[model samples]
Target: MKKESKTDWPRINAMRDEDIDLSESPELNETFFKDAVVWPAQKKQITLRLDPDVLDFFKSQGKGYQTAINKVLRRYVEAQKHH
Candidate 1:
């Protein structure tokens, strides 16, 4: 799966000088990484392949066509996936 961690790089770099040794503390590591995990905003980009008809239909919707396509696809995935 393709995934990304959302990190505030400047903040992380700043912490490097803060006299706290992250490697020495599991809790610190968890907390640091946890803060960097993003609940993706609707702004994130996703990449997927689609049949020509499906792509053309969404593209015909004008602006924000990708969002519409994703909405349709997200519902489809949620409905079909098995736990």
Candidate 2:
């Protein structure tokens, strides 16, 4: 995990328009995104191998570690689709 910088927002906002890329960005259509209901997909059980530290980190957060892992994986899948 990486430490987040508190001042990153100002730096990002200061970036030049030409420095930004929107080629892969989705269109901001209100009608397309409005009233969206994201229901979780059915889950399947399986054994997965993970680094000891990675497993320990989520487990240390106490309860719902499995759900946290699922959320992380889902985000990764969604991100990959945009690329």
Candidate 3:
């Protein structure tokens, strides 16, 4: 069974822009935008096949299994470069 949300969505949706308080928030200035640098991750998506047992072992460790696999692969590649 799905759990019910406790939030009052109707009341939140009915609120006007002026009704929200922004006193505690910081104001963004031109200097902030000018100094900002954009660094994008050049990741490519691909489908890979793994043996069931190997896949299960990574999944058993819980979240970030793909990242863990990537780290292992990266270390292997680095070792190969040194050889």
Candidate 4:
């Protein structure tokens, strides 16, 4: 069963930029972007069957469920390589 969110999203969306506090937030400068590394991971498409409950568990995580599933499988593959 899908759970309902108790968050007041509409009210939060209506808030102005100035109304939000950012005093503790760090400012990202050119140095930060310069040090950033990008990984262009290639993906291949394939059909895979999963149990209803297993599929539902991933789907319940909201958006990017397929990507989340891929991450889990990727970790499993990496762990097996170490054995």
Best model per lDDT = 4
Cα displacement (Å) at residue 27, model 1: 37
Per-prediction TM-score to the true structure, in the order listed: 0.38, 0.54, 0.50, 0.51
lDDT of 3 by residue, 1-83 (tens): 39998989999999999998899876678987775545448767899999999999999999999989877887797689879
lDDT on C-alpha atoms for all candidate structures:
0.74, 0.87, 0.85, 0.88
Query: How far out, in Å, is residue 76 in model 1?
Result: 1.3
Error of 2 at 46 (Å): 0.4
Ranking by TM-score: 2, 4, 3, 1
Model 3 lDDT, full chain set = 0.85
Number of the top-ranking candidate, with TM-score as the measure: 2
lDDT of 2 by residue, 15-61 (tens): 99998999998787886587453777878899999999999999999
Sliding window of 10 residues with minimal summed lDDT for model 3:
35-44
Better of 2 and 4 by TM-score: 2
Stretches of model 2 off by over 4 angstroms after superposition: 1-40
Give the residue spans of candidate 1 off by over 4 A.
1-47, 81-83
Q: What's the CA error at residue 32 for candidate 2, in Å?
A: 9.1
Q: Give the better candidate number (1 or 2) by TM-score.
A: 2
